[model samples]
Target chain A: MATTSRVARPRLSSTGDALRPDSNGSTRERLTALAFIAPALLGFAVFYFWPTLRGVYFSFTEYDVFNAPVFVGLDNYRALFADATFGNAMLVTVEYVAINIISQTVLALLIAVLLHRVTRSVFVRSIVVMPYLVANVVVALLFYWMLDAQIGITNQFLGWLGIEPVAFFGDQNLAIPTIALVNTWRHVGYTALLLFAGMVMIPHDVYEAGRVDGASEWKMFWRITLPLLRPVLALVLVITVVGSFQAFDTVAVTTAGGPGDASRVIQYYIFDLAFQRLQFGYASAVSVVLFVILAAVALVQLKLMRAGESDVA
Target chain B: MATTAAAPLDTEALLDRSAGGGGRPRRGPGRILAWVALVLIMAATLFPFLWMIRTAFSNGAALSTQPASLLPVEPTLGAFRRVLGLASTEEAQAQGGSGAAIDFGRYLLNSVLVSVLITAGQVFFGALAAYAFARLRWPGRDTVFFLFLTALMVPPIFTQLPNFLLMRDLGLLNTYAAIVLPFFFMTPFAIFFLRQFFLGIPHEVEEAARLDGAGPLRRFFGVILPMASGPITTLAILQYVQAWSEYFWPLLVASEENVRVLTVGLGIFRAQTPQGTPDWSGMMAGTLLAALPVLLLFAVFSRKIVNSIGFSGVK
Candidate 1:
């Protein structure tokens, strides 16, 4: 299974020497390194790089699966702007992302802080994080069963409280928010665990210092904890935003983007267009738009993080 | 102001005493509130799973009743038996009254095979590439690594349409390869994670191996791999859970019965059960079975998994 030649090599002092053009061992070292990385690089090229480029190309063409892709210039983009469902899908996606990020972040921060303060027991921490390991499909299914208007435990509890049993998935207005709630329910544990991990890295001395300064617990949280936790908090925010924008599995299983396209986010819209409607070119165009939005968001996050670091310095 | 001034000194004395005693700090009202909040959150978080267990054990008739019991009145394994294909249709109908036995065993096996292969493939290839990035020197290394990182920012939906078309043209649609190929090799996150770990290894160990006349491959295999086992194991667990939980791609490609993974199979199960009245008991059982493996993995490797999350965040 080994690909490299078994030639004995010199023990170079620094890695920089191995890259020198004048050295006799440089070519062989390069060969060995190339052999080591070839499999993954080859797979990446075939699966990710090539497909991404072709996808960009396809966005500009009018291709169904049946016919060869005919170059249509900007037709797909022009049509995407005019499509009412596409616009609605974008709006719905933004709403979904906003609710999901806000709820998940706030709940996760609360749970993480609580867990960090109360316990160091692995058992308790695992209990909080366990739901995250469960598949999104399973979470969506369980919630679907619980939110079933007629016999769902949620509705039953509401009835006991003298409230009307509202249809979660049946009503267009409640559908996206309901899905967002379920998504948050499924992921908040993970976000909390990640944030908790970050919290653990904050030295105990820092808290003691806050105590020394006569800071209230609330003051310490706002002034010290949140400020010190910026890096991980940014990570959590970016992950939540990216994930919520691409929300698919829960919507697929629960609403199927239903109640009259009320829950149809852009990812599901792309899936429906490509797989169900066979509109490959239009879907590609939408995919490019999605790609641009995500990339821009990531770049902005990186820039903001860098600026934050420099300010701290 | 006097109390606030004394509080820090008191806390310092407490800490010094605890340091000598090697015991935990005293619990206060804050601790009590934290516990109360934790208990409430835990109840909310775990209630769904508890409900799933209740439904899985209850018969279909019990579920249809008004004000469903929090605990099953008459517990039975009939739903589990039917979902696993171990129960006869006649027996299921006799017990639950309108249950159908799905070929869930096949789907379970498919899920296991796909997840294992993808996990193994990703960890192995990711390690190889990470080793190169960490220790080896080659021209254009930084550029190539930058390109790989760029892949992380591209939303997966961007590639789904083209990947589907490519799979169709290659006649790989509906095959397990279709589900496994794109993801099985490596991912940018895995490479970045493993590279950080590999870079932490001391250079002196590899130098000693060189003194013993060991080739680069032998040194890597005999030394670096063993030293990095902790991170490797963490990556394996994380990757396995991720692969098993995958849904969207599998649904897109593995539409055939023979190749269908559990997630897609469950989706189809939900869709196929008559509108407005689903097989709740059986569906609950299916959901339980699907979630059990990752849950078991977490139960065993909870500490390592938690540490891995912390480790990933540090950089």
Candidate 2:
């Protein structure tokens, strides 16, 4: 079964003999392939490729919404370096990404472990996954309402315990963390589902062997499951980090980067510059910076995972 | 590939092991504690939606009471009626102040139309491209596929400024085309996902179709597509949900009421409400209405959705 399945796998990256120049069907097959692929390629070029190239070009020029772009080499980057708000946004974004990664990963892993040990029914699992299906705007609005200082149920619950109603979106020091907590609440279920899938992929004999050796569940998980789950853990980390960096929808709905830019992450900052301030060139420069950071992180993650695979092999 | 093969077996083994009663007994204090913790987690996760429902069903006066009611106090469909434009003008004025009436029905229709079109377009084009990449041996296939994969790393925000500028240049702003065109045809993620599904299909089936003198299109439509219904359905649902819930791009391109989607419409409603004295019940009603479709989609196809997520992550 394994060998036949392996043989059946489509080789997407190779040229089969049927398509070689000497083959009788090569020309017809090539024409068919191009016809099949034309629509997607056209859309990709128009939407993705052209925009990306223009974005890079705009990063180097000075342009606003009204006028033509004037070429200025590296001036935008220099101004970005000297800008205080940009620096603050960078710091806040890094902080947000770090806190989000830690909290979401830990909570998701915990839930996945618990679920693996306890539940087997899809119904129970779906209840937990429900929050992830809600729109970001909806989640943000729901939490905004639930955390309202005067009439929110969260504060009401707190008041019953003799605590004052905290303004979740008002205070600068608490706003970013509050948003992070809400973001975590929105995403933890999906993350847990990913990790749960990874956990269930492990072979059963390993657990049987550990049990036969009188290892407790805790020991078995730490000694056996953790090592095997490293690749998936890396995957989860990469995805969450990339997502948190680009987060804008929730912030837009809940805070609009406001109460004096306390929760202004990079994406929101870029939107403010491009749309609100009309500094298209500067926004593109900031976008370039964000792209570099994300690309670097993704490359490092892929390399690390590849190295781990080689070690196992 | 190895893990994929092992996963189904692991599930079966897990079921058999638990049912055969070898490792640990089911009744214990620890087990009870685990169940308690699970239930608590479930409650915490679901509490916000419950609050939305509570607020959605109540009227302004009931919500404005000193302590908010956990249950609907004056249960009325007044907010829904107002949102859907089913209420009379006098009825709307009697409910609340300036923020009572919005063209929410138009927004709902716009959202539905844009989302369905984008989903159908994306799934169709994505499957065509994925089929070519998965089955046909063509020059530059790998390079083109790799290029598509690279788009995954380029943040959507990076392209937003240029795409918006392009829309403005073409005089497409405030039109549904502006909101729908950029994403209507194909996305890198969808193509990649469909390609993976296509690769998993056995080559023998396509060979059989070819032997029967079916053309490439016929083989794809008749042979491959029937086998791909699971992944295609998953992709369609996902794309629909995503297009429906999108906020940022729509907020940029389609700020006009005629083309406004639910998420942006809800945001506009929130902004129009007076700060520190928000129309909480109205905003909650808008949110509940916006969230209802995707939530219903989940209620029906949650297992397939979850499985697709797992497949994407693991694969």
Candidate 3:
């Protein structure tokens, strides 16, 4: 599509072999194309495409590895309604997503605007994104060390301020939020750079026009920059929200849904159900719900935010 | 975050000197405030890493007492030595290590093997599929591409369960193939990323090759691949970092000590140590080693990675 729009001509050769624009050549082209995509197609089928169908099918059955999946239509979904831990997982995941998205988006917006208006230093931006480049497990462990209740650097600093040491991961109330914050610290810079990319695409003349009208930086940012930046912000939100919903790695490494299941996001819960409890069918049901939620979120946000059609020309 | 562009900003003036828009003077309080925020962000961003270095160098026994200090307390190579299995059991215990004979050097090699294999396979197969999607006129082309893309929305857990079952049933568990198989194929993102790049290659480049009686394969190899090398390298870097940082799938499929990649090894290492202030120096040292390869890659390709952040989500 990208090529055809630009070239404005018939294809150089529909037959892959330009020397022979004949029936055999077209057949050869088809075979070549198939060969090109054969590995990906096989992988897609075995790994992705089939699993999606199997997951949905498993939701309707009662299966552990010992027995064949008994056809118990809707049993897993009905079970989920009464499952408090499943409900907690859903709640915890939502809380995590909300915290992560809000904090990350707000901080990233501030950083993006700062970079756009005051500095475009590659050095500064690189520093900001360093945490993101590290593995999630590595980041989680680093923070787990830094925020340990007794000897953590954070608590050590709090002591200097005469503040009570907080149990970042030990307290049930604090575990999820702490996990969210740790991830936010890792992510904020990358998010900021993403928003900055969007900000770069907005024409300078719009800001120039605002300055000509004697608009303060505050007013210009609010009235001009933010409005023109809707599409980009929407994209970032969609990406971040979707990404946060799959918060397994950090939780697995750090809290392990701990401080009394306070941080068991849905993904970890699914792992627990499928692996630890051997309830593969029930886990599949939860996964289906997660799949639906992600699909709905992506679609709804894109629709509401008008991601394709930007406010700016 | 512009984490990798160490080469670009070695000095203090992070502000791009070419920043001429907005008409704000360079010396105002607003500018000063911006610089302060930049400094604070940079400091906050780099602190954990710097602290990782500090903690990695500290004597694990002295870590808790001087946790707030900027420098290591009774600095030693004990942690690094223990994690790498260089320290004897008694020496490891003496330095507050868990005294587990875990070989991090082996895990590092394991990580190298897994990440390199996956990167090579994912990039190569993805490029092939991308070429088909971008350049071919086969029937159902766009539809097939769209089918591949919707896989992205399928949360990994959905596939992860069945894939694990498949791996186990095949009796491939604890082997690299089990872990590598799931990721060795092209990601939807990888395919999409390469396809987008391929589509932008001017047709004439391939047209000349084709007019020389070159077949599709020859055109792809001779013209398209070289022209799209930049995106290919970027995608490879992105994918390598991704494979190196992978924890979830590798954790599930390859749980054996020898097969375990760095992320999983680090997780288990963190788990093995006893609770209260348990040998953080050793763990941080291990963490730093696990993260080193990707960091080195980032240092070399900082701008490339930084430039590609806008399109990133897979990592």
User: What does chain B score (TM) in every candidate?
Assistant: 0.88, 0.89, 0.91
lDDT of 1 by residue, B63-168 (tens): 7674468896468998888877788878776555345547778998999999999998988998888888777777777778778766776788777778888898
- Which pairs clash (backbone N, Cα, C closer than 3 Å) in model 2? none
The numbered model that scores best in DockQ is 2
Instruction: List the candidates' TM-scores in order.
Output: 0.91, 0.93, 0.92
Residue-pair clashes per prediction, in order, are: 0, 0, 6
Q: What residue runs in model 2 are displaced by over 4 Å at the alpha carbon? A: A1-25, A311-313, B1-26, B66-68, B86-97, B311-315
Task: Report fnat for all candidates as fractions from 0 to 1.
Answer: 0.50, 0.48, 0.49
Off by over 4 Å in 1: A1-25, B1-26, B90-101, B311-315
Predicted candidate 1 versus true structure: per-residue lDDT over A214-244, tens digit per residue: 7766787898678777765765566667777
Q: Residue B212 lDDT in model 3?
A: 90
**Which candidate leads in TM-score?**
2
Please list the residue runs of candidate 3 whose C-alpha ends up more than 4 Å from where it truly belongs after superposition.
A1-25, A307-310, B1-25, B312-315
lDDT by residue for model 2 (A227-253), tens: 777776766676778888888888888
DockQ for the candidates, in order: 0.34, 0.45, 0.41
Worst 10 residues of 2 chain A by lDDT: A1-10
Q: Which ten residues in a row have the lowest lDDT in candidate 1 chain A?
A: A1-10
Clashing pairs in 1: none
Docking class of 1: acceptable
The candidate, 1 or 3, that scores higher on TM-score is: 3
Write the residue-wise lDDT of candidate 3 on A1-66 in tens digits. Answer: 112111112132233334344423366667888999999999999999887888889888888966
